[model samples]
Target: MTPVFQPGQTVVRREIMRGEPWIAMPQVCVQDDGDLLVTYTPGGTPMVYPETGAFPVGEHPWKLAGSTSWRGHGRLELHWTGVEHSIFLFWDGPQRAFQGWYFNLEDAPRRTPIGFDTLDHELDVWWAADAETYEFKDVVEFEETGPARYPGRMEQIRAEGDRIARLLDAGELWWDKAWADWAPDPSWQARTMPDGWATVPFEAR
Candidate 1:
């Protein structure tokens, strides 16, 4: 059974494949409506990424080689139930200046005993800080490494990008500029992953 999170509660988000976590981030939950989960992590939050020096980023997560702190913008992650992708709203600096939106195309998040797990598709879309201009990100990474990594799902991933592009074009999904004003609670401290975060059981993408 999945546990419900209260506002301001810290939960771990993990990227998993084949029963191992590739990366982990400790995020503070802002809202949970059963269908969607809104979470936040301020800039400088300690996080972990898959450690791959010569190989691609996702190549070695369980190893926890790329331990680093979240930088630049604090992200409000929007994870919709069963959706293939999640959107992130970014704010930078001490004043919490709103940056923009990021469409992270990935596998749908699966609720876990602790938090949630998903796989990054390597393709993403981004809107400028003012929301005036937009562009697709990680296209080359997706094209170069995706086909070989995801097997026959290359087209599926590209199609997901197309789907997100259409949403951006239609101004749907996290397109609201009002979210720019959203800020993390002042009393909240930077969240870090749990001691056994990587040990969290993977539920498959």
Candidate 2:
């Protein structure tokens, strides 16, 4: 927790699925104020793994996606202390237009020497820029992976999703247009991984 990172410093933000490394990738640190850590990855950043070689694509990627060239939209991740969910803003294209808000339901982010680790609790809530139309993203994936991923946390995951929905209904939430309008430094545009990104163990707190 004492390790401090500078803006543009590269670190590995790994997902600890089933207590082992699932997906790892390099992210440029935007800020780290102990409580709120912000990081971003340009579109097309490479995905790394603790183990070398190809990772097979599965039916449920959120469960276990293969290590391919990351074809997803460029994203900025907001990790606040002790929050049940983290907000990720996604954008694509040359204009880097605002896309949508993805509320990822996960355990509290566990700080690590490299960066942060968290077990992504399958079910998530997402809304477009309008925020008027919202939908749960991975119900099918959750049904298939939740029980096996974490034995007793499925009910808690459902409750957390409901809680977020309630807040969205009341218009009470942490992020808004301000966060959505963020733009990254042009210098951080390179799609690369850090020094130890592939070997940083997915140690859960």
Candidate 3:
């Protein structure tokens, strides 16, 4: 009961099979309500909680408010703190597409200092199961870093995404046109990770 966004809003994230839309800006603590206590449950020490590589994994895992669900399927882990991430998904019994994994935090050739390796970082994932979107941006031109943790320097995130895509191609505002429309489509093919994760159980959907 604590999820609300404002600052330039438009977070229509509908993920089902391949329709990943964007536009969610307003930086600096972006309207923090403690971001729902750091994305749920005792999770309130932020630093982007590994930059949004969310995880918990089964039988009520952490229920990011997706309600309650499970039939048979589990796997969750996304780590982004300077960039380097991974995603795994499953749930198909009540019709939630299925199968997912998209990571390319800069040529993920299994780079690990702790956990995460299987770098097929070519960056390609986009799922839009009717309207339940999923998006992971970064076209290509590898060499990434600068969420700032260590090996940070993808040419300084391409000179700060080319100075925010030249101020949204000169419109010069609106949060740099929401970071140049944050073109994300990476690719995933499954559905329903939201309806409160359907009771979260069957191995943590």
Candidate 4:
């Protein structure tokens, strides 16, 4: 598989929460085997906090929370194997180091002119750093929200989760230990989201 992005390429990754954009720069890496990897440090920017309620309202949409400046929280790494399946590794803030892999069962990312986009399936698997244990991370949450959100795809999504779970349990998964030791190049300047990034709506899987 040809890689879609070159290593060290800068790209904007935005997460839309309650119609607001939370953007970050994810550095790209192309593995020897042709899989693509992207990593970024999250929580550096001031995030939007809903003013009135947990859900968004027309009157008071959001307010900026955190420092006015960017602050680094933890590193987030994503390995995309054609988008049908992607593995995410997060920095466990409490543990103060790399946590473990999160298996996101979703549709393959569609390449856009600006960047890639994909909607996440509700189901996910969390593999502990020890690699000896794992658990279903969002089962109840998915059950509650998935039917309303995904409609007919819940069964397929759960099947994908089951397939990944089996692979993980059989020790057939891969984890890049080198990433734990990896850090971004100090020479790279801070990134901001380009204009019109939020205009494109990411389709649900």
Candidate 5:
């Protein structure tokens, strides 16, 4: 069955299974009658993208609340593109570590590689907004286990997260344009170009 999407409505959509293509979990979902009213007004309701597939930006600004690190309170922005992208800065209360989650459009999110003691560590967890699975990455050296497998099962998941973060930071998905200015040296222009060809006159020499 085709999924219906309304501009001002909230719905719960999830894939049938993990790693498999996300399918809309076809359970009856009701709009929060109260939420719809306020959402249309000045303050809008938070929308959840069909977790079955990649979600567009603006789906949820409240997801980082579930993070376990530093009480895990933060916000992630899924830019204009429908990719898992966000910039998160949080405090680790127990460890007293300052951390940041920088998501590049192409690379997995990368933890702050600087500004911390070598003994300090960072663990990043991403709940697939679609699949009911959790992925994690940790930035620390290992002793018993090689750096390749300290987090064990969570290793692959963390690598993927880091890769995606790199892509987002590089602006691979959406490139913003900037302007540059070039001014020619008055004296240099006169010597380089033919006398009549140069538009600006020499101020020196």
Candidate 6:
């Protein structure tokens, strides 16, 4: 299949928070087999945090606090080789560099006019900075939310999570060591979303 996102293209990555959109610009890199690799630094924008019961009585769910800047760089590899799980690597700021990797087990992204879109499965794995140790995260939340939200696909999602966990435990997964040494091209300008970015709606899964 032909890749939907091209190398050097600027794409808006829209992450939904409490039903609202949080956006970021990530530079795209298309792989030889049509997978997509996106990289971005998470600073310069106010980070949003969900605050429970922080808003007025009528605005409970949407209440949020935007303050701290995310001090890190992130690389996400979106695979096209079936099963659609993506691996994320994060390098923290100057203080605590090389935080580690996160495996996001999710649905295959659907190509949209603005960009590609996928729903996160909640279940994930975290490989520590040491690179050998790892842990399963959000299993309770995944079990709680999967049935009610995803219905029939809960079992499949769990299986996918297990598969990734095994690969991580056995040290069979592929990760680029060079990414830890990567820096953005100095000549590339900072990216901003296109005019209609906010207008593109993600279909409810």
Candidate of highest lDDT: 1
Model 6: per-residue lDDT, tens digit, 1-205? 3335555566555544334444334444433234544545433423322333222212312223433444345454544434557777666666537667777877665545666556567788887778567788999988876675567888899888788778766878566656555555555444545666645676545
Scored by Cα lDDT, where does model 3 land?
Answer: 0.27
**Residue-by-residue lDDT tens digits, candidate 2, 1-205:** 3566789987677776655666667788888788778888776777665554333332226335454555655678888888878888888777878888899998777777888787678789999886666899989989887787767888888998999999888888776458778888878864566676646555543
lDDT of 4 at 90: 65
Write model 5 residue lDDT over 1-205, tens digit each, in one string: 2233333332222211122211111111121222111101011112222233332222222333432111132221222222333333233445534343333212121111110001111344443324344445433422322242223434544564666556544655332211011111222110111122111111110
RMSD of each: 3.4, 3.3, 19.3, 5.5, 24.8, 5.3
Per-prediction TM-score, please? 0.84, 0.85, 0.22, 0.68, 0.24, 0.70
Runs of candidate 5 exceeding 4 Å displacement: 13-153, 174-205
Clashes (backbone N, CA, C under 3 Å), per candidate, total: 0, 0, 38, 1, 22, 0
TM-score of 5: 0.24
Flag the better candidate by lDDT, 3 or 6. 6
Candidate 4, superposed: residue stretches over 4 Å from native: 1-3, 14-35, 42-72, 92-96, 188-190, 200-205
Task: Give candidate 2 regions above 4 Å deviation.
Answer: 52-67, 195-202
Give the per-residue lDDT of model 4 (tens digit) for 159-180: 8888887877787846665766
Residue 125 Cα positional deviation in candidate 2, in Å, after optimal superposition: 0.5
By summed lDDT, the worst window of 10 consecutive residues in model 2 runs over 54-63
Candidate 4 positional error at 106, Å: 3.2
- Model 4 lDDT vs. the true structure? 0.56
Lowest summed lDDT window (length 10), candidate 4: 53-62
lDDT for 130 in candidate 5 is 41
Give each model's whole-structure lDDT.
Answer: 0.76, 0.75, 0.27, 0.56, 0.26, 0.57
TM-score-sorted candidate list, best first? 2, 1, 6, 4, 5, 3
lDDT of 1 at 155: 91
lDDT of 3 by residue, 1-205 (tens): 2234443322212111011111111111122232120011111111111112222221111234433322342222332333333233333444534444332233221211111122222333433334354454555424342222123344543553444345435654321113212211223112222232212221110
